[model samples]
Target chain A: MDVETLVLVHQLYGAQSHYIDEGRATEWAHTFTPDGEFHSPSYPAPVVGTAALAKFAEDFAAQPGVTRHVLTNLHVTPADDGLTARAYLQIVRTLPDSPPELLRLTTITDHLVRHAGTWRIRRRTVRRDDTKENR
Target chain B: MDVETLVLVHQLYGAQSHYIDEGRATEWAHTFTPDGEFHSPSYPAPVVGTAALAKFAEDFAAQPGVTRHVLTNLHVTPADDGLTARAYLQIVRTLPDSPPELLRLTTITDHLVRHAGTWRIRRRTVRRDDTKENR
Candidate 1:
């Protein structure tokens, strides 16, 4: 049971990272459920739906060159609500060919559910860590 | 098992938050092992031990006003290694009295282990989210 959840959660994170890295913004947005909340507080606004998510990622991907998100410290467990499991994430990103930029390192608190026999993020909130802006 | 791990992990996060809020830096630092790594990418230097962690929190708590950390979208799962589990965290902080500020929101990737019949953070890395300074 634990094995399955761990593998699934890690795979989901990996797949999402791939989507962002590959600029598959639409597919990346598909990772979440309808009406789900996607909150990256640093953003000018939160992206909530598939369309909004896609646009957010599209704009994000339009940044500079290639990007790599290095995610670590993944904690996962089944939620009390069946079919749902919550995860806490620590993630970092790097872009080569430049000053070795740090794109976004965030704590991704995620709500995932087993939809159609696979995991999907129902809600995702990327919180800002210290060392960020005043507000 | 899932219930136990979930409770434990959440407790860890909540407890750590309490420590930081209450200025119990030493006890909070004790939550990790001797060689544990506490990495918050935005900091000028990473806090890696009980002593360093204490100072880090001390300096942080030295800031005026009350701060509340809101962590959301938690994901959890067991790790490949026995007695260890990994977690991903998306966290937010709110400092009142000044335009509803947003402090360091980050994804905290953590390595936890069962030590002496309880769980502790073996390694923690708080990645920087976008909307931070040049790094």
Candidate 2:
């Protein structure tokens, strides 16, 4: 991918993280396509479609404590359909009167597409690095 | 900053992190200019020049545990001379039979200059988030 594409994708990651963490459910969902799909062991089942995605993020926002997604080591590649990318994600949570906690460590794979001149996630699959299968 | 410059600066962060974590001290030092300087509250004094930079990283390389620099929330702006950037950094360490630990949390500010068509750090200042002054 060209530098412009890489920077755009990186900004997408930043936007998604902030939207979700700050309880902007609709904005977070919009980071994805209308038919975007999120598959992860953290969730009981895949979240498909914009409505479902928004609801999923809303539910998390309703929970206690603040959650911050710390993502690192992003690698992006050009794909026939769009762009494929991988990144290491660390979910950190800080509660009142408690130290920030490391909630989960996982790897996220994203299938991104350009929608209306901006990058959006078409599909995202997350795998827990702490799991036996990953090891 | 333009997307291209943003991408180059981001890649510079990636390169420096890998080189230092992998104990390539000289290579890590080369990520900066020959007269580069690093100032951090973690260090007793500022490390200046190529030789001092290499030696600083070399000493860290001799440490026992594996350290990974997790950087996030990068913001870059064009400067008169080059580019100025800031990022949140979390240093994580893992030892034999132990869970990965959050070593430190800090904010890094960099004055980056283009050297030979690639971005290199001219100066870097780091402030610990845990410090009272920062809080």
Candidate 3:
């Protein structure tokens, strides 16, 4: 992929993490397309569309401790449809007066498209590293 | 700065981690300039020059257990002389029959220059997150 697209993808991931961490559900959901879809091992069914995506972010942000989605090792490539991005996600959590914990490690695969001159995720799939399928 | 330079810097970090993880000391050291320097709070003094850099990598690899350098949140900017890149580093270690542990978290700052058509680190400074300065 061209350097510009790659940087944009990285920035998009950063924005996603920041929005969700700050409990900005609408903002976080908007990082995806209007009809964006999210599939994850943690969810029984894929979350589809803007409203559902927003609700998903809301539920996640409602959890007890502060969380950070640390993204790393991003690999980006141009695809026939749009752009394909794969990254490692480390979810760290911490509570008041306690050391931060490495909550989970997972891989994120994203299909992104440029809509109205801004890159947005069309689909995202997450696989947890500790899961049986991964092992 | 420009996207192409940004991509090269990210790739350099990936190569650095891979070479050190596989115990390719010379290769890892070569990722830096001939007179590259590394300063870390864990060490009493800075490691300088290609020879010392190689020795540093060798010493790190000699330690027991498998280690992976997880790099994240890279921020790159153009400096007067070269590119300045900052990234979060998570040193994860795993031993036989044991789950991986996040051994340390640190911040890495690198001053990089283009030499012989390749990006090379001129200097790298590492500060541990658990250290007094960070906390």
Quick one: best lDDT, which candidate?
A: 3
Model 1 off-target regions past 4 Å? A1-135, B82-96, B131-135
Of candidate 2 chain A, the 10-residue stretch with the lowest lDDT total is A126-135
Go through the candidates in order and give each one's C-alpha lDDT. 0.63, 0.82, 0.83
Give the 10-residue window scoring lowest on summed lDDT in candidate 3 chain A.
Answer: A126-135
DockQ of each: 0.03, 0.16, 0.19
TM-score of each model, paired residue for residue: 0.51, 0.61, 0.64
For B1-135, candidate 1 gives per-residue lDDT tens digits of 355666666677667777877788787777787666787766777778778877877876787776655544344656765334333233333556555444434455677787767688888876544433312
Cα RMSDs, all models: 10.0, 5.5, 5.6
As a TM-score, model 1 comes out at: 0.51
Misplaced by over 4 Å in model 2 are: B1-3, B12-68, B72-89, B93-100, B104-135
Residue B97 of model 2: what lDDT?
45
TM-score (C-alpha) between model 2 and the true structure: 0.61
lDDT of 3 by residue, A88-131 (tens): 67788999899998766666778999887999999999976555
What is the iRMS for every candidate structure? 9.4, 4.4, 4.6
Q: How would you class the docking of model 1?
A: incorrect
- Say which candidate scores most in TM-score: 3
Error of 1 at A55 (Å): 11
Model 3: how far residue A92 lies from native, Å: 1.7
